[model samples]
Target: MHRLSRALLRALPRAPLLRQPPGPGRLLPAALRPGSRGGLSTRPRREPPAAPQRPAAQGPGGEEEQFVFPEYVAEPGPAPAREPPAAPGRPERRPREKRQHRVTGRPDPSVPPSGVSCSGCGAELHCRDPAVPGYLPSEKYRSLMGGQPGGSEGQGALGRVVCQRCWLLVHHQQALHMQVSREQYRNLVSAALRSPPRHGRRPLVLYMVDMLDLPDSVLQDLPQLVGAGSNILVVGNKVDLLPGDSPDYLKRFRKQLLRSCAHVGILPAAQGTGGQVARTGSQNLVDVHLISAKTGYGVEELISKLQRSWKCNGDVYLVGATNSGKSTLFNTLLQSDYCKSKASEVISRATISPWPGTTLNLLKFPIINPTSDRLFRRQERLKAEAEKTEEQLSDDEQKYLKCLKKQGYLIGRVGRTFQQQKSKAVIEFDPDELSFSMEEEPVFSSNKPKERVEFTYNELKDARWFFDTPGIVKENCVLNLLTEKEVKLVLPTHAIVPRTFVLKPGMVLFLGALGRIDYLQGAKSSWFSVVASNLLPVHVTTLEKADSIYQKHAGKTLLKVPMGGEERMKEFPPLIPQEITLEGIGTLEAVADIKLSSAGWVAITAHLEDKLQLRAYTPEGTTLIIRKPPLLPHIVDIKGNRIRGSASYRTKKPPPLVENLKANGTNKQIKRVSKI
Candidate 1:
C-alpha cells in the first residue's frame, strides 16, 4: 500500500497546492486543482489581470482626452521614516503638528498705556469717556500734558494734575457720583497691606474708625485680613463732630472704642484682670488714639507717638472703611512734620470730600526718618512755639488759628520747621499749575491760596513710604444707597450741634426720611438727643401719624434730602422696623444709643425706674445698633435750656476759643483772649 501511494504522488504533475475549487469563469492549472495531491510544486506565481480603462471623450477643439480619477492613482514617493524610541528615564517628545500654541507674557497692546493719572483719586487719565472715572476734557488734558511749563523731564508733570471730578469737588464743594463695589475696595486695601519679602518688616496699620459711626466703622475681619500678629494702631477720626473738649469724656470715649474693637474680634476680649487684658491686647494692638482729622485736634500728638514707637521701622499704612476720614487725614499728614521735609514739598494733597471712595489708589509720601538730631530740633521748635502767646504768632498763623477755632475748640495748627520754611522758597513755580488754597473748614466759602506740586521719579525711589489705602465699603451702611446730593446732607462737614427733644410715650421722632423712632412703652417722658448732621431736619409727631407723615412728606422739601421729589421716593428703600427693649439708668445719664445706619444716633435718657420698649426703623438692608453705656453717656448736658411752649430744646453753640482754652487749663496764656 505505501509503494502504491508513492507511485501515485510521483505520477501527479508538478502542481501548486489549492485551498478551494475554482469558479466557473476562472480557471486553474490541472495540477493545482482541488482534487490534485496536496504537495508543494515548483511553479512561478502569476499576477492578477489589470482593470480595463474607459473610452476617450471628444473635447471642444475636437481633440481626444482620457478621464483620470486622482483618488485611485497611487503616488510615487518614499514612505515616511518612523521616530526613534525614547531613551530610558526620558519623556517622549510630541510631533510639531500635535503641539499646542504657546502663550507669551507680554501685556495687551490694545490697551493704551497710562502715563498720567489723577493726583487726587489715582484714576488713569483719559479724555475718551466722560461718564467713567478719571475723565477729563480733551483740551484740558492736552493743556495739562503738553502746555504745562517745567515738564520735569518725563511723566512727573502728570502727577500735579487733578481730574475734572476732583476739581469740582475741591473748588465748588460738589461731589461726583462714583460707585465702587465692596470687593474692589477690599482688594485695593489688601494689596496695600501685603508687604513684599524685601521690605523686611510688616507695615504699621493705622486702622481708622469713625467716632460718630461706631461699630459699623470698625471692620470685623481686620485681624484676619492683616495677619493676627500685625501691629495695629486704632485711630478714632471725626472727634470734632462730638460736642465736647473734656479730657475725662475723651478718655471714656477711647475706652468705648476699644470695647467696640474687641466686640468686632479685632482685639481679644477683656477678661480676668483689667491690666493683664490690656497688656495682652497690646501685643497686636500697639495703641489706640482719638483725633479729629478735619480740625487737626490730636494729629500732632499722634505724629509724635508714631515717630517714637515706629521710628521709621517700616512703611505705615492708613486703612479704614469709607467716610472714615482716611483721605482727610492723609491730606493733613502730607503737610505736617510726619512727612519728610523734601518729599512734603513735592507731594500733592489727596482730595478731601464727604463722598465715599474719594481715594482710589495708594497715595503715599516718604516717611521722615526719626533721627536723634531731627527729634531734638522738633522738640526745641515745639517748646519755643508753646511758650509764645497768641500775640507772638505770625498774621497768617493767627488767621488760620482763628478759623480752626470755629471748627473745633480743641484744635491743633500745622506748622513748618525752620528748615522747611527756608527750603520752601527754593521750589520753582510752574506757570500752568492749577493753584487753589486749602479750605480751612469744609462748610465755609473762603479758601487760602496755595500752589500744588508734583514728585519726580528720583524723589520716590528706595524710600520708606506712608501709604493711604482706599477705604473699604461698609456692607450695612445707608450711605451706599443714597444719591450724591443726599449724602452731602447726611454726612456732617462741621461740628455737630446736639438737637434735643422731649418725647412722651406714643410719640415718634423722624430724622428726615432716613430714620424713625417710636417711644412705644415708657413710664415717663424721655429726653432724646439727636446727634446728627445739622443739615438734616428733625421732626416730631404722634405714633399714629408716623406712617402717613412719611408717605406725604418723604423726598419733598419738608424731608430736604433725596430732593428729586416723588420720583426719588419711588427708588428709595422702604423703612423696616426693629423692636428693642432697654432699662433706663437715670434721667441725667443716657442708658443706651440707637444708631440709625449712618444718618445719626439718638441717645435715650429716662428715669432709672422706667422700663423702655422702643421700635427703631431704618431703610431696608441697613443696620440699627443699640449700644449700651452710650458713647456719650452724658450728652444731654451739651444742649441749651428747653424751648417754651414746645417739646423741642434750643441747641447749644460751641463756646468761644478763649473760654475753651481757659476751661482746659492750657499752660500758655493769650494776651488778646476774647470771645468771637
Candidate 2:
C-alpha cells in the first residue's frame, strides 16, 4: 500500500504543486496566440545604446587614433567640497539660506515644509536633528509660535523663536559661560558708545551697576565710555542680595560708589539746562536708583523712568557688567512691558544665567507705545496725579515710590561726599530727563566740550527701540577664579546664612578654593564673622598643617563644593598662596581686615595684633585685594550678637542667582589694607 501511495503521489505531482513554467520563446502576437489579448508576449530586455563611433581624424596632439569612450570622464558637480565633512577643530557652520521643500509621490498628500528659522538666534530651525541648536519637534515649534499643538500646519511659525542652545542654557541650568576677548569687548563697547541715534534724536544711557559688586572698574570708566556729556541713569541692581536696609547703609553704599568712581576720575558731565545749582561736585550727570532685578522690587519704577527717558530721547542703551544682572533686568522689564513677552520668553531674548557674558551680541527690543488717544488720556492722568497729595495716591501710585525715594538719597549722598572732599563741583541733573544741570560751573570751553550730541528731538512719538549690549567682564573679580559649578555654590542664592567660626591663633579657613585666610596671630581670641554664601564649603585646620592640607586637599577634602565629583576637583591648579606679616606695633594692637577681592573679606579684630600673618590664596591668575573691611553695618559678633546702634536687618531670600565675572586683563595689582 505504501509503494502504491508513493507511485500515485509521484504520478500526481502536477496535482500537489504546479511545475515550474518554461522560459518564454519567440511568441506570436496576443491576437494570434490562445487565451491572449491583442498584445505581444513579454517585452524583451534591451541593452543600452553604445556611443556612435567617429571616423579617425588627424589631430595635433591626440594620442588615440580612434576616439573610444574617454578614460577620464568629468561632469558638473552638485555640492562644494565641504558638503560633508568640515575642517577639523573648527565648528561646522549652518547655511544661512534654506533648501527647497520636498513633495511626496502620486497624490503628494505629505510634503515636507520649508526650513524654519529661529527668531532668537536666526539659525534655521529643523525638526530632524535633536542635538543641534535649531532642532525642535514640528508640533512644539507650532505650539510655541501660538498655534495649537498637533495642528495640521506642522510647519513652525515665522515669529516662533529660541534655538535649542539658548533653550537648554536658559531653562536647563547649563554651566555655559560666554567669554569674549578683551579686544572684542572693547570693540563692542566702542560701538555702543558710538551708536548713532535713530531719526537724529538724542540717545540716552541706562548705566546698570551691580550694587553688591560695588567699587568696580567699569563704574570708574564710564566717563571714557559715554563721554562726560551723555545722559546717564545709574541703575543699581542686585540690591536684594544685600543683608540689610538701614538708611545709613544706603548712604554708605552711595558714597562707596561715588568714591570708587571719583578715584578713577569719572566725574559726571555738565548739565544741558543751565540752572541755579549748588556747588555739588561733578556728580550731577548721574541719577542712581537701587532695585533688585530678580525680585522685581524696583523694576516698575525703572520701567516708568525708561518710558520717560524714551519720550525725552529716541535712543536708550542698557549697559552693565556680565554678572551685573543686565540680562535679568532686561528680561524682567520686557515681561512687564511688552505684549509679546511670552514669545520673548520662548526665545529667551537674553538668557539669564549665573555665567558671565551670557549676552554676547547686541539685542534690540521694540517698545510699542499706546495710540494717540490713549497716550493723551495717560498724559492727563499722570499730570493730574502729579498735582494730587501723597495721602490720596493709590497703591499703584505708591508702588514705585520706594525706588523713586532712592534717587534722592543717592543725590544727597553725592552732595555730602563732595562737601567733604572739596573735589570738582558735582553737577546735578533733572531727575526726569537725567540731563545734567550745571549753571554754576563754566561749560568746560563752551563748544559742548566736543562731546555734545548733534541729534535734535522736535516731536516725541514714543521711542520705538532700545539697544542692549554685552556687559563688560572685569579681570580681577574672584568670581572669575571659580568654576561655574563653584560659582553657584559660592554665590548666594538665598538669604546669606552667616556662618560663624571660632578661631584661636593657629586656625586657618578656606572659602572654597578661591580664597584662604590664616590667623597666624591669635590676639585676645577675637571674633571674626565670616559672611559668605551658605553653600560655601569650609574646612577649618590648624595653621601648622594648613599648607600641607591645602596641597593634599586642594579641591578634594578641604575645598570640595563644586559638586563635579573627584574628577573636577583635579582640574584646579595648586592654590597660589601669599602671606603678609603684620609685625609693627600697630599690627599688634589695631584691628585689620583682608578682602578676597570681590568674593568676601575677613576682619582680624585683636587687642594684640602680635605678628598676625594673613596667608591669602587664590586661583593662579586671580587678584587678591586685602583692603579695609567694607564699611557695611549690621554685623554680628561671635557671641551670637548684633553690634550696638546698628541693628541687623533680615531680608527675604534672594532670587536664585550667581554673581558672574570674567577676567579682562592679565595685570595683577595687590592692595593691602593699612591699619587705621
Candidate 3:
C-alpha cells in the first residue's frame, strides 16, 4: 500500500510546496517529502510579502495617482563610507570624537592645561606620566582642580597646587627620580630670562654657590647667561656647615671665594697692579656675602643689601647648581622682610632637600617694595629688638636663641614690623600647616610629624617678584649618583665638626666610600683636616691595603654612604684616582684643599718647606679639585689635641655665642649658652 501511495504521489507531477499564511492554525511541514528520505528537512522560514497601499484619488486633471508607503522611502544623501577591517589580533581604533572620554566630558588632566603650572616647582601640571617632571596623580589633580575632596573651591586655590615631585620632596623628604640633562636645565633658565619683565626692567641675578662645594657650585658663564650688563650678587650659602666662628676666618673665606669665582671666569682675573677689581664684560659682582640659609646667619644682611643695592628696580632671580641651598634660601627669604608682607602670607615654600635636582622649575614670590616708609618701620622694629639684652628677652626668645647657637655662630632672627604683627593676629593659623618660624629649630625625629604650609595667589599683581630658578645640575657632582638615603648621610644637617687626621707618606684616609686621599709623597707627617658632614666616618689605613679595604668595606657599615652591600657596589662607579701636587704655605695654615666632589674636602697642613704629592680618588666621572689658599686657611687650629693611639684628633668645642648689636649709638652684647 505504501509503495502504491509513493508511486501515486510521484506521478502527481511533484507540486511545488506553498508557504502557509500567518495564522494560529498553520499546519506543520510534512516530515517526508515525495522522492526523499523519511526524515525532517530544515529550511529557512520566509517572511510574508508587505501589504499594498490603496490607490490615491484622481486630481481635477483626471490623471490617476500612485501611492507609496513611508517605510519604502530612501535617505536623501550619499551612503556612508565603510571603514577597513582591522588586522588579526589587534584592537579596532575608533574616531576620537566617538571614543569615551577619560574624565566625564572633560579633557585628560595628564595633558597640561594652558597657562597652568605647579606653584612649587613651576613645571606645567600634568597627571599622565609619573616618570616626567610635574607629574601629579589623577585623583590628586582632580582635588587640585576642585573636582575632588581636597580640591580648590575657586581661583584663590591656584597658588596652593604643587606637582607630585615637589609634594613628595617637601612632605615625605623623598624625591622622584627624573633624568634631566644639563642642557635642558640651561634651556629652562634661558627661556625664563628671555621673557620680558612685567614692568620692563632689568632683573637682578642672585648667583648663589655652595661654600662647601666651591667651583662646582659656581656657574662659570653666569655673566653671559644673565646678560653682561646685569647685576649679580654672588651668594655663598651653607656657611654654618664650615667649622670655626672667627670673624677673621669668615673674611679670609670671603676673599678666597672671590678669587675662586675669578678663577672660574664668573669674575674678572686679578690685575697685576694691586688689589684692584677688574671688570669682566659689563656685569659687576655686586657683592659676595656668605650666609647660612638654614641657621639664618647673614641672611638679614643679605636682605638689607637687596633692599639697598637692587631695591625694587627689578625682579630678583636666585640661581645656582643642584644641592646648593637655593631652595632653602628661598624659603628663608619668603618669611623675611625680603618678600612682600601680603605675598609671603600667600606664597608657598620651595621644596628643600638633599636630593639633587629638587628644584626643577621656576618658583617665585612677590618682592617687598623697599619704600622709605616700610624701611623705616622695619628699621624701628629691628632697633627695638636690638635694644633688648639677653636678660631683657622673653623666656621663649632666650630659649630659641640658645638652641640656635648650637647650629651656627652668627644667627639672625626675622623681625616683623608692627603692621605685620597686627596682620598676623587677624589671620587664622592652620594647625595642619607646617610650622616655620625664625624661632623654631628643625627637628629630624620621625615620630614628631610636621606639615606643609598651604598657600594662595597674591592679590598684589603689580608687585615685583623674587624668582627662584631651577638649580643647574653640576656634571661631576657625587650627589647625582647617590640615593636619597645616602644623600642625607653625605649632606650636613647640623654644624659640621672638623675632624683632623695626621697622615704620613704612604698612608690613606677614606671619607666613607665617597672619597679617598693618599699621602703618596711628603717629607714629614701632615695634618689633614676633613671639612665634611659629621655623619661620614673617616677611616685611616696604609696605602698598600687601601684598595683591598675599600673593596671589602664599601657599602658596608664601615663605609656607610652607599649602604646596600654587594648589590649597591655592583652598580656604583669604581673609584678613579687623580694625582695632585701642592706646596705648603705654613703649618698653622691649610695650604690647599683637596675637594672630593660634593662629598667633602680635605685641607692639608704641612711645614713651610714641604712639597706634598698626593693621589685623590673619587667615584668615576666625579670632580677632583685642588683649591689653593684653602677656604678656611686656619682650619688646622680648630681641632683639639691628637688622640694618643689613633690618627684622629678630638673635636674642639664650639666657641661662645655673642651678638653685637648697636643701640642708641652704643654696642650691646647678647650672650647665649656656651656649650650644649
Candidate 4:
C-alpha cells in the first residue's frame, strides 16, 4: 500500500502537491486534470506510514556511491506583457558619459633644484621659499599652483614667470598687426616661383582664359612656368551668352584664329587661301576646349580631367587674371548640395588674389607625403636663395658656416671698406631650377639710390611662400624710400624697381575662339594673337566653338585681314568636304551625325574592327582625322564583370537619347502616359 501511495502521489497536480502535505487531499482523484501538462506537481507525496531508506555502499576508492537530487518547488510568477515593434526612424541608444575627478601633478625625484626670478618683484629665491615671489612652499604647493599633470618639475620646464607688476607692464602694449604690402606680396610670389618644389609628380595648371579681353598682363608666361610635359588645360570663361547647340562652330573659329595667329609669327602653321593646308589626311591633333565658369557648363569636364590628373598625384594651381573667376572656380569646385561655404580662409594679408597681377602667389600645403621633412628643407633652401645674395651666408647656412655674401648670386659688395662706407648693391639670382639658361643678371636702374639690407628668415620666408608675384623686375637696386605698403601697390603694375626684386617670369595660355571667328569684326586684333606672340607654348589647341562661322559669313562683304596668303574674309562655302575621324587608345564606340553648312553628300559610319574607330568621308571622297584616342588599361567592374569600351563623339550637334520599346506594339504611348 505504501509503494502504491508513493506512485500515486507522483501523478498528483504540482500546484497543490506542497499544499497537500500528506493530507486527505493527496488521495483525491481529480488531482490529474486534462491539459494541465506542465502544471503537474513536482513535489513527492509523503506516506502516512513509511519505511526508512538505506544509504548506498562506498566504492573501492572510499567515496560515497549514490545520492538523491532535491526536487524543485514551482512558485507563482508574474505574467509577461506583449511589446510593440520599434518605429523605423528611431535612433539606437548609446552609453552615457562618465565624469571623474583627475589627480594633478606628482613630484619627480629625478629633476634638479633650481631658483627662479619673480615677475612680481626683483626677488630671486630657492624653490622652497614661500615669502619670495619666485618661491614654491613645497612640492605639493608647487604642483597645485603649476596646474600641470607632472607636478613642479613639468611646470618649471615651461619656464619661470615674472612678478605680477612686471608682467603687466611687459605685456601691456597691444600687439600691432601689419599686413604685407603689395610689393612684399609680389616678392613672396617671386620666392615661391623661384623655388617651386618637385611634388614627385607633374603639376596640373588650370589655364583660365578671359572670354572677352584677355589682358596682356595676365598668365602671359604660363608655358614657361608650367614646364614641358605638364598638363595645362585651357578653359574659356563666359560662354553662357554663346550658342551651345552648334558643334562645328568652334572648329571653324579655331581654323580662322590659327590663320590670323600665323600672320603675327605666333601660331605654328600659316593658313593658305584654303583652310589650314590639309595634312594629306594625316591624324588630327588633340584640341583645346571651351567652358564658361560663370555659367557652369563645361565645368564638369574640367573637374573630371582635374580628378584624373590628381589621381596620378598631380598638383593643380588656379591661374588667371583679376576678376576672371579664379576664386569663383575654387568656390564652385568646393561647394556641394550638402555643405555650402564662402571659403574665405584662403585670404591673408600676403594672400594672392584672383585679380590680374595679384595671381602670382601660390600656397602649398602638405597633403600627400607629410613625413618628408628633408623634401621641405630642400625647397626652403631654394626659396632662400631667391631672396639672398649669391654665395651669401643665409641664416640656415650661417648656423653651420661663415662666409662673405655676394650681391645676389655673384661675389661682390656695394661700397669700399673705408672711403665709400654705404653704397647701393644689387644681386640677381635665378629662382627657377628647371630653366638652366635663364638670365640671372640683377640689373639695377634705381628710381632712388639702392641700399643694402640684411636678410632674415621668418620676415622674408613667410611672404615668399604665400604671396603671388607675376611681374618682371627690370632693375636690381633695393630702393630705400619704398615702404612695404608702397611696394604692394606697385607690384601688380610691374612698376617696381627690379634691381632688388624677386622677379617672376611671365606665362600665358591663349584660347582661339573658333566659333566666334565669323562674328569677329577685327579678327586681326584678336586676343589670341596677343598672347601667342608673348607667352608662347609648345602646344596649342583651337577650341571650335561654332558649327560653321565661315560658312555663315560666306558671300557676305566682310573686311578681309590677310594673314600670309590666307584672307580673313567673310564666311565662304569651302569646296572641301567635312570629314572627321577620331582614333584613340581603346575601342571607339559611337559618333554623332555630321552637319555640313555647305550641304554636300557625306558618308559617316563607326567601326570597332581594330579597337574603336570612327571614319567619315565626303561625297567627293575627302577624309579628315578628328583625333587619336588614348590607350587605357584593361577595365573591369566590381562584380568581376568587364566594362565595355568607352568613347564620346560629338559632331555638329550632340546626339539625342533613344528609348526602348517592347516587341509587342502594345506599349503605352508617350501622349497616353502623360494623362496618368
- Residue 423's lDDT within candidate 4 is 42
lDDT of 3: 0.71
Model 2 misplacement above 4 A = 1-158, 175-180, 217-222, 245-247, 269-284, 308-312, 337-349, 368-462, 562-570, 579-593, 603-612, 629-633, 637-676
TM-score of each: 0.73, 0.56, 0.73, 0.25
TM-score of 3: 0.73
Ranking by lDDT: 1, 3, 2, 4
Error of 4 at 558 (Å): 30
TM-score of 1: 0.73
**Quick one: best lDDT, which candidate?**
1
Model 3 per-residue lDDT tens digits across residues 255-348: 8778877766566433545777667646667678888787776777688889886443588888888878888899888888888665565677
518-543: candidate 1 lDDT, tens digit per residue: 99999898999988887787777777
Global lDDT of each model? 0.72, 0.51, 0.71, 0.29
Ten-residue region with minimum lDDT total, candidate 1: 63-72
- Lowest summed-lDDT stretch of 10 residues in model 4? 495-504
In model 1, what lDDT does residue 550 have?
Answer: 88
How do the residues 1-676 of candidate 4 rate in per-residue lDDT, one tens digit apiece?
4565666667553334444335533432345432334433444333334433533333322311111101101122433322333478987545456543332333343333344433222233234323223333345434534544345564453233442222322344211122334455344433443345454554444545443222221343444444434444555554322221233433433443333223322223224565744321111112234454433434544543443344343445555444344544544444311011111222212212221232223422212121245335434543443344323544765432222111010011111111213446675665563344323543444565333233345433322111112323212111111223222221221100100000011111111111111111211111111111111111111224123423343222221111112243222112343323332222222122222111111111223322222122221222222211100011100011111220111111111110111112332331121111
lDDT of 1 at 585: 88
Residue ranges of candidate 4 with Cα displaced over 4 Å: 1-199, 214-220, 227-229, 242-247, 252-287, 311-313, 336-360, 363-676
lDDT preference between candidates 1 and 4, better one: 1
Per-residue error for 453 in candidate 3, Å, reads: 14
